[model samples]
Target: MTTQKIAVLGPGSWGTALSQVLNDNGHEIRLWGHMQAQIDEINNNHTNSHYFKDIVLDEKIEATTDLKEALDGVDAVLFVVPTKVTRLVAKQVAETLDHKVVVMHASKGLEPETHERLSTILEEEIPADLRSEIVVVSGPSHAEETIVRDLTLITAASKDEETAKYVQGLFSNHYFRLYTNKDIIGVETAGALKNIIAVGAGALHGLGYGDNAKAAIIARGLAEITRLGVKMGANPLTYSGLSGVGDLIVTGTSIHSRNWRAGDALGRGEKLEDIEANMGMVIEGISTTKVAYELAQELNVYMPITQAIYSVIYEGKDIKEAILSTMTGQLKTEDEF
Candidate 1:
């Protein structure tokens, strides 16, 4: 494969890990972040100690603070920034972009204000003339494990088949695998909504609930995700793919998940502000829970699990009370969706 100069926006854990993957594929990586100290670390020491304490990055992956420098004639741009700032970053990219390039984002959350998916935000902020169809890279992968070169598998989804395959080729390697999917709607929805379930799973664990409870949350949470996804025009079968149940499983069960960790703190009676402050990273699920709850209400979909989590996070409801109300609600069939 021909080498490409790819711009990776965001120097967070996931962004850094993805840069390492691209570097491993023999591609030149321009990792862009806002912090000067982190950029200096990546450039001078070949490490981002703030995110990856013991890990060392490849020397070929250059770090930058200038948006224009990062986007300068790159073949593709991968966005890994937090969902809250995706639009802001996209606008900056649009201003700096002078040529058409493949655009992809690994962010998983809906816009709290617009309740739109990250790709929609990117499409709105970045003009069509400057980029190809937006591609979403998502699945059951975590940066902590991926940074260590652990075997990881994820999906590359786009309405344009060629765009998805192009991204699949760009990131795939011996330890990292990519599957192409045409259902961008399902892939993105599943990727965002699963974070809410992971918070619920973590809450259950923190409340001393056993494996059975977590399993129930995972299974029922997936049903909730599919119900809303289908309501929003996503293919039902896509929920069974890597971006669906696969992502839900990993995020809900893993200790590496920030959403899960945040929920754990909440379950232990910690304040939301405290949890956010201590985590030092954006827990995508916290905001995603609110957006998913609003979306479900607007779409008139049945999502009791999402509702319960939403109550605990947003409505200041007691965790135990929320779970109790959810459990005692009207009986329904297992295959309601």
Candidate 2:
């Protein structure tokens, strides 16, 4: 296999884990981040202690604080930054790139202000002449497990089938696999919306709710996600795939999910500001809840679960009250959109 030079623009948990995957696939990787100390740690110690405390990164995975140096002569760029900073980083990437390369983003969340997907932000910031069709890689995979080389499967969605296939080959290994999908909208929507449900699930768990309640949240949450995604031009079946129900289940149930953790804290009476300050990571669901709530209203989609979570986080509503209201809302059929 020919070794490809790839730049991973983010040294956060996901970025660091994916750099290992590319390194394992015999690729030269330049892991970029804004933190100078983190870069030093990855280069000298071969570990990002801030994100992954126990795992040692591969020695070949070079870490850099310089964007231009990271982008120089790379075949593709994988962005794993948080949604809040995607546009800023992508703009920097656009200014630094000297040649065209396949651009892929693994970040999941709609832009808080614009309610736009990360790929859209990338396309707007990174000129068409400087990159190929944007690819979105998302699914049930979590960085905590992925960093340890656990078995994982995810989707690579793009408008261009060849590009999706290219990404599939680039990241696949014995433990890490990629499936190609053409429905970029569904893949991205599912990826972003699931985090909100995960938050709700965690809140349910924290509020002393049992398995049945969590299960209800997951099921109804998928219905809500599917409703909005379909309204946004996503394929309904995509919700049944890895990026949809699969991701929702793992994230909503797992302890490793930042969104879940945040919701748990909120359910336990912690303030949103306190949760954000202490987590040391971006809980994409918090911002996503606001965006999804607004978008659902604008699109005239019924998403009671999303509204409940949004009320708790944004409106300062009591978690128990918000959840209770959603549960006792007007009667409807299970299949109602």
Candidate 3:
């Protein structure tokens, strides 16, 4: 309701798109990216050609390379960096902070090194005295469509309801709607794990499998996701919510998903290195598959789809053979978790 200055740390497609939403909400924005060229481009030309090829940005969205400058006098911070660099960016923000500010991240993927959620890493990185509420923004939304003002709905989840509600207000608009959720664990877990299934979906599509196969992959993927999510202290019902099934549907079905595109290239017989090299963006599901597979094993949860995808991505297994093996394996009675 009030005009505020918000700092968005990251200039990638998602971060850039989210900045546009905040700008549209009558908020002053400080958009930060490490690349000098991109920052200059956004500030001068009002465009990010690398990420959003044809999209023009708002001239009011100030671009910066300095984290301290971005966070200075800002009301809130939105982190939208890669999973690999989440902590690195958070630590920079922590060091720059001299006042309490609301923090939320849209990054979806576990830390491969610690298998920790992005919020967990944020908690460890940011000093409690300097940070206000921590929230996670996620759902079945893509940056490509979001920037174009297409109808989009997402969730702002936190351990504290007020925190979630605050974030819901932070970005809500006619074209961009947000729902508040309390289960940060479920929301975050579902957000990260769905990419693994999406990769599998894209692989199935690339391998010439029809709708039935993709549908089966999604259904079983949700089950596997819920199994692991519950074991990780998440509510089973949250898997049925927007951050879960909703997110999965979009990422698995859309061509805009880098994870799905990477999997498709894999199914097309491209080497993992080659696929990654050419994609030009982080294929989150590729790293998430490793994290989910390891987490499933450590938690003793059954996740055949995750395992098969993991094998194809990490263990040099043929994607087609792995899918075939999963299809022909002995069946077990399914239970709704």
Candidate 4:
């Protein structure tokens, strides 16, 4: 593979971890963050104090607040910004990016108002001809575990197979495994919608439901994702792969998931606003729930689990009532949909 300078926009935990991997592989890295504090900590202290707190960073990663400076001389860009912030961040990056840079995103979830995927936003933000370089890397990776050097597998999906391989090569490490696929739509959709299901599973867990309940919800949730993904021209098998079932299993079961934690609070009788206010960080599931709910309605898709969580979060319906409604109001075969 050809060597290239990598620019990672967004200094959050996932971005920091990915930048660390690339830096460790001897690639020059330029890191960017909207917050001066994040930029300063990465540049001066060689650590992301706010995000990857306890984890030290590589010396080769140079942090900057200037988007132009970060993109300068860089061959590829990894966008790790929040889903809601994707459009704004991509616009800034595109303004100064003169050369065609292979773009990769680690963000999951959709824009609530638009119900658009991250890649869809990228297409609108970047010039049309340049969008073939857009790649999506997603799977069961938890940034917390990645920072601690835990083994994780992720998929690099793109219309351009060569670009996918380029990103795969950069991210592959002792503990990080990378795979490439052409199913960008399926992978991206699964990555976003899985968060909504994770929230539902977390609510079940927080309500003291056992493994059987979690397992059932998770399996059913995968069905919902597959139904929508297949209808949208995504490969059916992609939903059965790491970016789909693997991600759902990990995020739905792991406590490290912020989305799941937010749902836990809700399951324990806390309000959505209260949980979100206390968490500080983005609870992607909240926004994802809204987007998935709206998309399902528009597409005429059946997403019971997503709808249940959406009702609890948006319609002010009681969590217990939502759960009971789902449990008692269904009696169809698995293949009915």
> How many residue pairs in model 2 have overlapping backbones?
0
Error of 3 at 65 (Å): 0.4
Q: Number of backbone collisions per candidate, in order?
A: 0, 0, 0, 0
RMSD of 4: 1.3
lDDT values of the candidates?
0.93, 0.94, 0.92, 0.87
Name the best candidate (by lDDT): 2
lDDT comparison, 1 vs 4, better candidate: 1
Candidate 2 ranges with C-alpha deviation above 4 Å: none
Residues 1-337 of candidate 1 have per-residue lDDT tens digits of 7999999999999999999999999999999999999899999999988778899888888999999999998999999999999999999999999999999999899999799998999899999999999999999999999998999999999999999999999999999999999889999999999999999999998899999999999999999999999999899999998999999999999899999998888888889999999888899998998999999889899999999988887888889999999899999899986
lDDT tens digits, residues 1-337, model 2? 5899999998999998999999999999999988899999999999899888899988999999889999999999999999989999999999999999999999999998899999999999999999999999999999999988899999999999999999999999999999999999999999999999999988988888899998999999999999999999999999999999999999999999999998888888888899999999999999999999999999999999999998888888899999989978999999998
Every model's TM-score? 0.99, 0.99, 0.98, 0.97
Instruction: Report the Cα lDDT for residue 239, model 4.
Output: 84
The window of 10 residues in a row where model 2 has the poorest summed lDDT is: 200-209
Off by over 4 Å in 1: none
Write out the backbone clash pairs for model 2. none
What is the model-wide C-alpha lDDT for candidate 3? 0.92
